[model samples]
Target: MPFYDIYSEDVRCGRGASKSGEETKTAEVFAGDEVGFVVGRSAMEPLEPHLIYHNGPGQVYLSQSTAADVREYEGDGNWFKISYHGPTNDSWWSTRDQTGMNFTIPDSTPPGQYLLRVEHLYVRYPIGTTQFYIACAQINVRPPRNGTVGAKTPSPEYMVRFPGGLAVPEYMYEWPNTRLTEYKPPGPALWTG
Candidate 1:
């Protein structure tokens, strides 16, 4: 029955607001058990429609994945509704509240870290739809008493390589104080000077 919080970093309320980035919160839970988490408003205002839904908004997705085998659970394929403030609803204006749903992790799932992807989408007219933002969470599920699973390898570091040799540093050559007429070209004795 461990609890966690999920919220957006830069919540905005307008049509032209940017919707490119998202933040994810992760937790560890046991297999064959229900992992309870909360998604609500951290501030006094709920996530508005104009900010998220430019055209037509749809139900937010709570996707789950695992490192081991994929097994079906009781609430695995179900879609839950999250109540939102309609455009015309004035009774509960500017109040930050949340509705929640319960889902159970499958007992047949493997004992390893699983990923849960949460995305917000909108369906617009003329065009089909697009995902505005996406966030993810990792859950470590323990194996059953008699079950065994393998561990995961760490991710590799990202690097960039230049095609040619490294870029040459810029150098500035300045001539000493001498008139063009007074300057004489270097001869074979230039190295001796």
Candidate 2:
């Protein structure tokens, strides 16, 4: 995992904490495989536990990408929101006290290289919820066991950039005291294929 060390905190309060990933070494996965990333440090919980991916050319080397910037691509949308973990009626937050956030690769996902992004917006921090922590890992997804399922090309509305993708909700401004009866992770909805 290419996670910037916790000691790197002094580097701008947790924005863009990506430690460059490996080019040759990549996590191999098949469609429908449940993959996850553990938080680098225990003190960190994957708030909003937003997991998204971008299938780009070459190592898919990108720290951030917006829908507009991705339109130039040849096929599926650049970034796809695979999953989002948030608070529930019974739990304060879904990602609390868990090994990590797990998401199944949609069966229709094309077999190729992609950038898996795990990000968390630290809500209760000296810096506030806007404090963003992000890490990108390289993975090579193989064909689904059933066969090559036709993948759907996600629309531009289904993609979002990292830094600007998560827009802080109005309730989070006064966080710690914000009455969050329902916490929805900010970003486009998950693109389930």
Candidate 3:
């Protein structure tokens, strides 16, 4: 659950380089646009046969807050929503194997300042241990050119607490187990908005 700001640093530091700090850079995205991140050293392999939708060098989420200033955002309200990839699991892959990953910005998402959060979850390595590599990128969400905002709205169903979201199963953290066909992603359900 240790959080960083970006992934453009030394690999020796591992995912620690993305941790949030005093300084940060902002990436801009329109309400409806495709955004992707280059597979940097921050990527990690999953412990189990991860579903493509949940697998990642890390999961990318969007929030209006920087995630540090809790005074402005608190409780479930501070939560960030997963950026929609698509209907299929085509975007899923081992962060270690892929060059990058992409997702579409929903037109319904509110336009404002946001923090693009990237998280890399590792369930192996120590065998039965779980580690997380999280990074946040500052972003500004602009309205679509037509000026018509999406009808859909963000709701509680799309929110989940960071440190407490993933409740790992013994099969997921331990190696050599059954291959699960269905998987509920660690956090709350995907917010279409």
Candidate 4:
């Protein structure tokens, strides 16, 4: 496997960014908060630009076996509803540095621990190729509540679980050598109920 690096940080959650394996949390806020992620990369060689998709919604409905079955879905478009904020090209260096991406959890987004899967791909030449995985960060989106500067806001009791667990898979496509490499991120640091 070639050396590919993936790094991410939560903008809403104030924390100095670090390589994958570092654990972080978001600031306690209302249920419907617009959260963003600052994702960057460093690799031995320039990598081809790939698509980043949030498979959260699909995970909410699919079963564990079904979720892991990437073949069941047809391309990134089928697996996730993607929204790009960066350059859309086939160049590998597009994501080589710090790139900012934002995702707003619906006001109706249940308050609980959510798994945000980040998938990288080079989708201009041979369909889906060039892949990498980033460490999953825990986001604790609090619920609405009344306050008088010190009143405690009760946390909602909603549970959000990723269909195939939180361990993201890492695979790569080296043209002639196409192989699926299992990449495991750091373990879950904290648990929410």
Per-residue lDDT tens digits for candidate 1, residues 1-193, read 1111112222111121123212323366664455433443335555652233222112221223422422221112212121222222212111123232234554444455444333332222222122233333455566544454333222122111111111111110122211222221111111100
The number of residue pairs in model 2 that clash at the backbone is 0
- Please give each candidate's TM-score: 0.32, 0.62, 0.63, 0.36
- Tell me the deviation in Å of residue 193 in model 3: 1.5
Clashing pairs in 4: 47-92, 48-92, 50-121
RMSD of every candidate to native, in Å, equals 25.5, 9.3, 7.7, 14.0
Ranking by lDDT: 3, 2, 4, 1
Point out the worst 10-residue segment of candidate 2 by lDDT: 54-63
In angstroms, the error of model 3 at 74 is 10
Q: CA lDDT of each candidate? A: 0.28, 0.49, 0.51, 0.30
Superior by TM-score: candidate 2 or candidate 3: 3
Off by over 4 Å in 1: 1-26, 41-98, 128-133, 144-193
Which tens-of-lDDT digit does each residue in 88-173 have in candidate 4? 23222233333445555444433444334443333222323223333334344445343212222223222222222233223222
Model 3 bad stretches (over 4 Å): 1-22, 42-58, 66-77, 84-96, 124-128, 173-177
Stretches > 4 Å off in candidate 4: 1-29, 43-98, 133-135, 144-193
Tens-digit lDDT string for candidate 2 (55-134):
00011111122223222221222466776765543224555445456778888776666666666545432333244445
How would the candidate models be sorted by TM-score, starting from the highest? 3, 2, 4, 1
RMSD (CA, angstroms), candidate 4? 14.0
